[model samples]
Target: MNGRLIAIGDIHGCHQEFADLLQLIKLEPGDQLILLGDLVNRGPDSHRVVELARQHGAIALLGNHERRLLAARRNPDKVKVRDSEKATYSQLDDADWAYLNAMPLTHEVPELNMVFVHGGFLPDRSWREQGADIVTEVQVIDRDGRPCKRREAPEALPWADHWTGPPFVVYGHTPRDDVYKLKWSLCLDTACAMGGQLTAFILPERRLVQVKARRRYYP
Candidate 1:
C-alpha cells in the first residue's frame, strides 16, 4: 500500500501543542508529514519547533512569517522587523536558518490531485505560475481581481472562495476560528497561536485530527 500524506496547519512556535499533536498522530515511517508552514514566530521556543520538524524530516513549506524572516536576514537594513519576529530570529541557529531557507513554495501530490501551499492561489491564473508573494501572503481577492491580505481589503472575498480545482489546494496562513473547508480548498490555520486548535489533514482518507491549544500565546 502507498504511504499516507498528512498535512498539518500553521504551528507558530506552539511546541508543546505540536508535540502533543504528533504524539496523537503516532506517525508511521511511510507517512509523509507536510507541515503547512508558519513553523516559527509568535509563540514560545521557535528553535524547538524547528528542531522537532527537522528530527521528523517534515517537509516544511515557506509561510509568510518564514519569508519575512529570510528577507530580513538577507536585507536587515531594508526589511522592518517586529519584536516577535526579532525573538524568533534570535532563537534560530544556522541549521534552523538553513531549513527555513530550503523550504519550497509548494508541494504537489499528483496522484491525489492535491497541492499543498503555505497561503493559497489566485483562481484566475495558473497556480503553478504564481509567485511567492501570492502563495505566501494572499488571503483575499480584491475587487480588482488581485490577491491581497484580508486586512488590506476587508470587503474582499477569500481567494479560496473563487478557486475551482482539480489539484485541490491545502494551505495555511490566514488564521481563523475554525478550519475553512471549501469544496476546492481547505484552510487549516486554526489560530493555534491565539488559543485555537492545531489541525492536521490526513490524506487518502481526508480525515481531520486536531489538538487544542494549551493557551493563547500571542495577542
Candidate 2:
C-alpha cells in the first residue's frame, strides 16, 4: 500500500504551529508530507520551519514569498522589507538557501493524483507549457481560461471547475478565510502569516487538519 499524502498549507514561519500540527498528525513512516510553500517570512522561526521540512524529507515547493526573498536578496539595495521577513533573511545560512533553491517550483505527484504548486496553474496551457508568471501568480479563474484577480469579478468561477487532470491542482500563495476547495482544485493557504490556522489536507482520506496559531505574529 502507498503512504498517505498529507498536503500542508502555507507555514509562514510558524514552526511551533507546524510542529504541533505534525504531532497531531502522528506522522507514520508510511505518511508523506508535502509542504505547499510560503514556508518563510511573516512569523518567527523560518529557519526552524525549513529545517523541520528538510529533516522530514517533505516536498516543499517554492512559493511567491520565497521568490520575493530571492528577488529582494538579488537587489543590492533594500527597497521595502516585508513584515517579519527581516528575521527570515538574517537567519538563513548558505545551506538553508541552497535547500530552498533546490526545491522545485511545482511537484507532480501521480500517486496522490495532484499537481502541487505555490500558485494556481494555467487553466488553458499544458503543465510544461505554462508560463512562469501564470504558474506562480494566478489567483482566480474565469470561464474563458483567464485569471480573475478578484473573487467579486462578474465572470469569476472557481479556478478548478474548468481545469482538468490530476483530479486536483493543489496550491497555496493566495490566503483565504477558508480553505479553497472546488471541483478540481484546492487552496490550502489559510493565512498562517496573519495568525490564522495552519492547515493540512490529508489525501485519499480527504480530511482536513488545522491548528490555530498561538498569537498574531504579523500585522
Candidate 3:
C-alpha cells in the first residue's frame, strides 16, 4: 500500500526488453508489480521471463496465450496450439506450469477503484462475472453487443471506449504502438515483442515508463 501499484503490458516473452523495462522503472521495495499476462510466447526466452517475474514477486494475470496453453496441456486432443507458441510451450518447466496455473484473471486495488486484467472486459456486463474467454481475448465490441477481437468486428469500437466505470481498468493483450488511454481504462500493451516498447503504468503517480525493444523478435 505504501509503494506504487504498477501494472505492465503483455510481455510476450521479450525477456531482454522486460528486463530493461524493469531496470528503467527502478522497481522499489513494497511496489506491487502486476503483470498483465502473456508473459511467455512470441519472443526469445519465455522461461527467463517467468523467472524474472517470480524473482520480482510480480502478480501475473492469465492472458489468452496462457489460457490456450493451459487448455492444450489439459486436453491436447481438444485444443490446437499455435506454431508461434510452440517454443514457449516446450520451454516451460514444472515451476513455470505451476506459476501459470496460479495466475488470476484479474487483480484489484479497491481503494483506487482499479482492476488490472490481461485484456479488456465487456462493458455491458458484470466485469466480475466474465470469464477468461471474454476478458483474456476481447479487443472490440461488435454491433451485436458482444465481446470480440478487433478483426472479428472491424468497424466496432474498442470495449474501453464504451466502459463506464467505478473500477478503472488497466489491461494488456491488445498490442498497439502506444498506450490506449480512456477515461475508464488504460491499455498498456505497446507491442514489445514486435519491435515496440515495453510499457509500465504506475498508479498513485499515474506515470508511464517504457523501454524500447532491442529489436523485433517476431513478425
- Model 3 residue runs over 4 Å out of place are none
Q: What is the lDDT of residue 5 in candidate 3?
A: 83
How much lDDT does each candidate structure score?
0.92, 0.81, 0.91
lDDT of 1 by residue, 4-100 (tens): 8889999999999989998898888888899999999988988999999999899999999999999999999999777768889999999999999
**Candidate 3 minimal-lDDT segment of 10 residues:** 117-126
For candidate 2, the TM-score is 0.86
Q: Stretches of candidate 2 above 4 Å error?
A: 74-84, 141-158, 164-166
Residue 206 lDDT (model 3):
97
Better of 2 and 3 by TM-score: 3
- The residue-level lDDT of candidate 3 at 110 comes to 94
Off by over 4 Å in 1: none
Q: Tens digit of lDDT per residue, candidate 3, span 48-138? A: 9998999889999999989999999999999978898889988999999999999999898999999999888897778999998889989
